[model samples]
Target: MDMEQSRQKRSFAPRALPHEEYFAPGHRGCQGCGPALAFRHILKALGPNTVVAEATGCGEIISSPYPQSSWRVPWIHTAFENTAATAAGIEVAYKVLMRKGRIPEERINVVAMAGDGGTGDIGLQALSGALERGHDFIYVCYDNEAYMNTGMQRSGLTPFGAFTTTSPAGKVSKGQSTWKKDVPAIAAAHHIPYVATACISYMSDLYRKILRAAEARGPAYLHVLAPCPTGWRYPSEKTIEIGRMAVRSGVFNLYEIVDGKKRLTVKVRERLPVSEYIKAQGRFRHLTDEDIAYIQRRVYEEYEALLAEAAQI
Candidate 1:
């Protein structure tokens, strides 16, 4: 084997495969779908007694089909705007059942999962309500940055200057001009027990975050950067690589907010230009040199701000 391959083999830590599969393989998702992988890792950490409340998006459709379903756990598909509400209800039900000795308190963990559009936009209010109410559950946003299931449309979480169906680049416009919403920061503002941002590229870190979130006493939110190959217009095999590039370019930082304190979990060893990350995906193909420069500036500024926040902690 080559030196690089030898080094990789030495550094690799095999993950303990979970015997209970929450998501079966029969359902359809695009090749190299990050959300599918995210679910698998999440289930590995959460185990079999967990119940999932999924919103209307790629996750729901891909896991449920007529008489057949991919989810091995108890799953509920709710409206696009009500994932948090549904999860809150399930949590309340679990508490009541446990109190009445109708169900074992340790038997289940409730989790709410949604895509960026569903969590960052449509379900934001419900999520905020659940957190403010101190619901005992975990809310996970598998963010691919846009509404991937709905034809790659722009959502509030779509990054600045990225092209989507709703924010197409043209002679008069230059893709999405606004910045991506800081959903984890917003969740932190709610003063919940825990909030963290993770990416699928770091499987071990992501798994640990999910496990922590599940064990927390009150409401917890995990915002995961799950790449969508089809939506980003990238080759299926490049999904993990693209996700890694996003973090290394400062476009996405992996961090955790515990009890209102910010902490940086993964630091980029060698930062690359934002254009290098954008160029890998066809969604940003229409961007001009000026646009790429603007994005790079914004990414650096955001990374610096995160560093400052971490410093304050």
Candidate 2:
């Protein structure tokens, strides 16, 4: 076989993603909802022995509605700001039960799920406490860049130049006046055993990260960028495409921090111009050339800084 042929074959090798479905179909999620995809892969990685505490957000509203639920595992509905606290309590309770011979001592992957608003904004205090107290659970933040469940309101995790109900672009100001909050960095600040960033567009990477997070001895955080077609004003079919564009354009970089050391999971050797990502979404349609250029520059600086930082360890 030729060297080129061999390289191509290796590049296209199939991934061994679990076929078991934990997130059932027929939910109310909008077409191409990235969080829905993230949940499926997350559960696949964690397997059946998992308990999820979901915040009152898009995932919660869609997956659970009164008499019906899409989750096949033990799921708890939590308030927007107390998801992590709930998960922490569950983890502690499980330990106590095992100690008292009330429940089996088998490992149970405790997961706290929330949207960006719930994680970076309203739930920050509760999440911080859970992490600081060294809870043995996984916290997954499905960041679609806004309070999408309530109303496409602006969130701290929303990138600059993206329009939303609260941070709408107008003649007076550009959308999202500030840069996106670095939630992964904040999670790492707690010196947790594991912290990582993932995206639905990259399922294999996300799956591997979840597996690692589940195995962490204490306080693992996974921040996943779930592009929202409804909020971003893009076609539902373009969800995966846009997510890939975001990663390739350096709008989001996939990485993991293990025990205070950082490393990139998906390296962007030749980054696509940020315009490729921005121009595709209506939220960024109003951005002028100068605004895009500024954002592009910031993306470059941040990407480079991360590369350098990750290289140190």
Query: Whole-model Cα lDDT per candidate?
Result: 0.88, 0.91
List, residue by residue over 213-275, the lDDT tens digit for candidate 1: 876889999999999999898999998999999999999999988888889889988898888
- Candidate 2 structure quality by residue, lDDT tens digits, 170-193: 889898999999999999999999
Residue 252, model 1: lDDT of 95
- Candidate 1 ranges with C-alpha deviation above 4 Å: 1-13
Query: Can you list the residue pairs that collide in candidate 1?
Result: none
TM-score of each: 0.94, 0.95
Q: Which regions of candidate 2 fall more than 4 Å away from where they truly are? A: 1-15
